[model samples]
Target: MTLKSALLAVLFASTAAVAVAQTPLPPADPLDDRSAKRVERMEKVVRELRSIVFQGRDTGKPVVVQPAETDAQIMSLNQRLSDLEQTLTRLNGQNETANFELTKANRAAADQKARADALEQRLVALENAFNDLKTQAAAAPAAGAYPPPPAPPADPAAAFKQAKDLLLGGDYGNAEQAFSTYVTNYPDNARTPEARYWLGETLFVREAYTDAAGAYIGAIRGWPQTTWAPDATLKLARSMVALKKTADACRTLDELTKRYPKAPANVTSRAASTRTAAKCG
Candidate 1:
């Protein structure tokens, strides 16, 4: 009986303690709350659960996350850098090419100018050579061991004047010399036949029939085809008659008539008249 009453007493004490612990408290007014206690309680519970599951701890600092970069943004930056490098390389290549071409062109142009200058110099040298040759060709021939080329014939009028002057000075010897000189010096002179005729007259005046005949013969021979030929032949015949060369005189007359049949008939009449007047017919 004594042990049973001890156990009943311990049970009645535990029952009374439980009854006090389970008794309800008085309710607070909703408007009187100044904090979100319910939301705070839920956040505290989530933090505890996440730490236990992921971090292996119930109490520690919150986790952190870095922002991720987009693929298009990274690709765009790399492409821009590559394009810039290519542009720089192309510009450098173009500059080198332009410089090389310019140098080659300049050298070619200089070479061409040099060739032109050389050609100009050669032309000048040739021109100088030509001028020198012309100068040498124009120089007169060497000195006087050689006989001088014959002088051009004297003026006919001047020769006749000299002959008349010597005749008027009463210098028959000089007159003969002058007349002879005139004939020799002016073989084809226009006054040559007239000079010869005058020379014959001078010799006749001096009574030199042989010399007169010789001078008259010169007139006949010198102008065989001239207007003076017939007169000269007639005078020659007269001079031959005076020299007592009748056969020669007759032969000359016959020759004149045959050679100049076309001559006027007065040509022979004049020859006959001159011979008769000279008292030699």
Candidate 2:
């Protein structure tokens, strides 16, 4: 039998033992003395023939119980049965307490499992986001990452034309770079003076008057006979005036009017205007 059934059976036997102990024998007859004597015979027969049943959990073996003869024996057996009942009651209470603790433990474990599952889901989402960022980085390059490398066109005329076009288009930064490149790569080319003069133009329009003056001086010294030479000299005077060097600028304009006598009328008029503006002697 199951342990619960076994304990129940033991309890049932204990109850039966109590009932048997409580049974009253037949009462004596008042007119018959022998009938009263037969009461002792009835009691002895009950004591000899009586059997009780008990089973142990370990062995599952039935134990034969003898009936109690004396009052002391009966009382002792009753006390032990009462003690057993109290012990069983206490054991049952402990079992219920254990079952309750076990249920709470199960609930705690389930809650922890749920939290762990949620954390795992979040981790997976983060990993997917990281992978998406990695994919994007692989697909596209960074902005302003690669600059145009150093380039000097093979043909000096084409290069000069490109630099001049850039200057005319008002792209001063690239025009400066392109003209500077042309000057460096083709110093002896016939177009170099024109390129350097345009370089000064790029600087002058940007209001970098000091750099413009230097570029004009380079063109005049390097290609004095070129048509760009007189142009560069006039611009040089203007650049010096922008620098607040009125004396130098006036002397330059004076030299220009004398040295390049056949200079453009516009150059002569600009020189006169600049001389008047500065009150040149």
Candidate 3:
């Protein structure tokens, strides 16, 4: 063979062997049995090609011309190695794609499981709430089956003090009942206007704004000169605003400024701000 041709043949064989060696090996478990076997066979073929390409290298034969039959055998081995490598490449790509699809499917399954668990918990909460309500309804007394406790006695000072204590103690529900009872039992008491104002305050703290307005109105109109009167007027306007009765609240604030001209500076200032927020003319 010509010297240049022999050198070219050696270079080509060396390049092909190195390329095959650098090609990544297939993973042991890529979820495709057939692809795994193909990769395994490809690896064996690469090893055989390496043996053929460098067979006499240890004996100092980098490139050796063989008989025609040996050359044919080398060519056959090279062709088979090339085919095996192509098959391995295709199989590895397909395996990677299939693995990605499986990962997506697993993620979707986990997401569905999480949603189902959340739904089950919500259903359990709803069932528990319904059962509690059903039990409460079953246990509740029919109308007048149980009468309310006796009205607070008509001791004007002591009764009103008890209700006021309940208010200060943050027992707003009982304070509401106590104040209502006090107003009922001692409507003509000397502290009736103050009592009414405090009742409105109790309701206001409990977010019963409409009821608070009625009680405040009582304190303002029934006993206008009482110490509670100015504060009650202020609170009545605030309660009207809270109830979203914009016009009524604005009119009430106007009335507070006009009718209670001697009201405190802070009360007047707050009413002005309230008027602005309510967009009053």
- How big is the positional error of residue 251 in model 2, measured in Å on the Cα after superposition? 1.2
Q: Tens digit of lDDT per residue, candidate 1, span 26-49?
A: 466332243346444544544444
Q: To one decimal, what is the Cα RMSD in angstroms of model 2 from the true structure? A: 27.5
The estimated TM-scores of all candidates read 0.36, 0.45, 0.46
Assess the local accuracy of residue 62 in candidate 1 as a C-alpha lDDT between 0 and 100: 48
The whole-model lDDT of each prediction reads 0.68, 0.78, 0.79
Model 2 regions lying over 4 Å from their true place: 1-150
Per-residue C-alpha lDDT of model 3 across residues 87-125, encoded as one tens digit per residue: 999999999999999999999999999999999999999
Tens digit per residue, CA lDDT, model 2, 1-281:
88768666766655665566556655672437785566556555444433222234445666555444676788898999999999999999999999999999999999999999999999999999999988888788663143343465788888888887777776778889999999999999877777778999989988999999988887887437766677788889888888899899998888888789998888788878888876799
- What is the alpha-carbon lDDT for the whole of candidate 1? 0.68
Q: Judged by lDDT, which candidate is best?
A: 3
Residue 186 accuracy (lDDT) in model 2: 93
Global lDDT of model 2:
0.78
Question: What are the clashing pairs of model 3?
Answer: none
Residue 273 alpha-carbon offset, candidate 2, angstroms: 0.7
